[model samples]
Target: MDATTGINIAKVVGPSVSIATAGAILSISALYTPLLSNSARSQSSSKPSPTVTLPSIRFIFSRGSHFFPQAATFAAANFGYLAYYSANTAVKVLGMEMGTRTGFVAAAVLSIAIGPITGLMLPVCNNPLREMAELERQGRGDEVDEGELKKMVKRFEWLNYVRGAAILAGGVLGLAVVIAEGK
Candidate 1:
């Protein structure tokens, strides 16, 4: 390869790979640890505890705030990078050359799907915090409904998995394509 080509590869592929890898690590970490889903359980109990399970709700909510936002940031970055690569691809194809960017259009769309997932994630993360705070204000923490709380937390946790997988898939695929093209 020419020197300029090598430089371009280094500039684009190097940071893209690093960012993708870092985002994947963060996402997987959040999935395995309580960083996103409060439970280490392989599965939520088949029977959600009876009544307003305040402690469970609080646990997930507190921990959701702790790690989800950064994960969300990574999700955004994954989408942003995919969009960047897709733009490059579109331009190349339009120029009548096969894009050296190679692949990841589907991954890009999946990353965009994160938009709506995060849309759902917002309320799941925030509503609980607000509700809990309001409860504390009114001295009714016990009033949080277990069933509803479980549903909300489930949605939050499920959304995390969906986005995490998207981020990881998009990132890995992007890195692989860039590296292969670089080669």
Candidate 2:
């Protein structure tokens, strides 16, 4: 491809990747929101007798919450693929400068890393929800171990923040690519 064509492709995909990265960051923030955590806590606290079956975890929190992070992961992955392509185009096709090339490379690497890291942590993060669902199925949600739940919440929070930071870093690197392309 010509330099102009490669530059144009980088220009187009850069903004798209930025937006998706932003969305992923926002969604990750929501996953650890106080309100959601409070809701889960309240639901757990208000459970009926140990013998009575409680509603599934799916019912406790908004079902949409469960799917949002997954969608964010998909979006992150899409951004990674596009960023990788754009970085390649910028470096190989467009013959961008060393600094510019390095930025794109960093962006591409971060984006690529973000998707899998988030995907892997997602299940680990959602383990509590899954456990709650199983507890409900067993009619023993009231018996949930608070210590374990707290530990799970802490793990989820920190891991998700790490994922969000990865996206933020990726977004910044993408901006670097945009700036370099403008030169």
Candidate 3:
């Protein structure tokens, strides 16, 4: 096979590998978040209420708290794919010219991806938290306005769709870059 054909295959495969890696990492991280939160609660309160066992793994997966970590994974996967293409291109053009280490490249790409995605989505996440706090302030005892809460939930849902679109675009762009630059 030609070098171009080889690079094309790598371009197709890299994102899938990165996504699988990121997803495993995020799953492990997510398990730890509840543990961390529970530990903090235990430390702060003398007698904490019984931990609410999530009804099912599916329910747990559906929660808003899960979205950030998933977004993080998506960002990391995209960034990793981008960096691999960038480095592979560099190597083709500058043989024996040391490019950035894979880890550094991955981190930098992930950070760049995360920065914009998080910046855009975090406010949507915060809306529900802020609304709940407002409900508490009004002495309604954590009972938020149903309509407002629904609006916040819809906003978050829209953000998720947008994130999915961004990921798709990143994947397509990354592939185009590799195809265009390949020998």
Candidate 4:
């Protein structure tokens, strides 16, 4: 079904999905890389490298602290937009003279679900950071045990994995919609 104007639905939604997918992948990398770097730095037996400044570490931490929410918001917004676009496309297809297509329906349904799932997961995953900050504000940061910190980190990582999976799934489903157009 052709759009009312000259707009191509595929062209718009295709890139939206791609952008959302790329953002999700980049966000995952950003979230995990520092943990790997810190782990390696801690495990090193050699004297601490003088080149790696504390300020640099703090800068990385600060960037990460801000990056997740922004990236998640951008990614989620794109997915949500894609969902809205796809739903409209589905309605258009249904009203078309050729009748309804299963592929468009599938895309609409998947898009509807993916937007909210991706949006919600990031904040849930970042809960540990909020908890830590709260403890610091309460003057009880020192009270948080290493074990608790480790558990929170683990939980965050796991949630990120799930979030990544959701993003990936959305990308794949979006691809399916693209491919279905070929038939």
Candidate 5:
């Protein structure tokens, strides 16, 4: 391929693939949220429904925090730059075909919408879990209620559903753009 063909391919393919990848990762991760509960209904209210112990829960919480930030950092940053470049460079500099240009321009807006939402929402959901994890680590696990934690896990799953839907929608839309552009 010539230099122009390479740049055009990068402009269209890079952002589309990035969004699809991010969406797939988030969606797959969401599937495991139910496991966090590990609920086995009890005969009596005295026993907590979720059997995952506090220490185990804390471990998961600690590990879970680590995963998103890394993904958000690398994936979000990489896509942000690519989509920005695609939208700007493809239309203004590269002068991509009208179909490809429209697709790239639309993708520039659609692709990164999840980053800000996740950025704002994750801390909201994670703060309580973080505090509970820290307390569990410091031998205050007794104070951390597993029932509340279960509720939070449910909320996490719900949040992930919403986020996953949005991100996956972007990915699907990006795929549509790819098809529309015939690239």
Candidate 6:
């Protein structure tokens, strides 16, 4: 690969590593919140709360941490090889003259930017719905007073689709930037 492609690939490596680390941290936090909340509730209550049978965050982290490096290595190897083959095949089929350096630059930029952008936006779109569903499942289903419920419903109706669309737009913007720069 050319110097530009090499630099681009190297630049992406740090970001990808950071993204993986952040994902691990977020997963741990998700587990911790429920465990800590349950612990606090149990401590305050006369009757012990039902045993929370959720998986352990620490255990998941341990297992995931152990496997992540290997998984990342395999993924990088496979993905790089696939990109090489696919780009070569496409160039041959289309009678285009693009170099592997260009392909590498494109792939590196797109993957680096898109991966974390999607990672960041995914939680924004998903967390509220997940929270609302969890609340409903915990017996808070549509139990708000009529006036409050109406207000909430109206607010949600206005905001829900907007929030989702914003997440999508953010992802698209990231991809667009990568493509524009790579090209």
Tell me how far the alpha carbon of residue 44 in candidate 2 is from the true structure, in angstroms, after superposition.
14
Scored by CA lDDT, what does every candidate get?
A: 0.50, 0.53, 0.43, 0.45, 0.53, 0.38
Per residue, candidate 5 scores C-alpha lDDT tens digits across 103-174 of: 544544445555666666568765676676678778776787877877766666676556655555554544
Instruction: Put down candidate 3 lDDT per residue, 51-82, tens digits, no spaces.
Output: 22111212333463465455545545544644
Model 2: per-residue Cα lDDT over 10-78, one tens digit each: 555654555565565556446543333334545655322222212422442346356534544543454
Clashes of each: 1, 0, 0, 0, 0, 0
lDDT, candidate 1, 92-175, per-residue tens: 222334453444443444444555766776776647745754674576756655455556555555566776666556555545
- Flag the better candidate by TM-score, 1 or 6: 1
Ranking by TM-score: 5, 2, 4, 1, 3, 6
Clashing pairs in 4: none
Let me know the TM-score candidate 3 reaches against the reference structure.
0.41
**Which portions of model 5 miss their true places by more than 4 Å?**
1-30, 39-102
Task: Say which prediction, candidate 3 or candidate 5, comes out ahead on lDDT.
Answer: 5
TM-score of each model, in listed order: 0.50, 0.58, 0.41, 0.51, 0.62, 0.29
RMSD of 1: 7.1
* Cα misplacement distance, residue 140 of candidate 3 (Å): 8.5
Give candidate 3 regions above 4 Å deviation: 1-10, 17-114, 127-142, 181-183
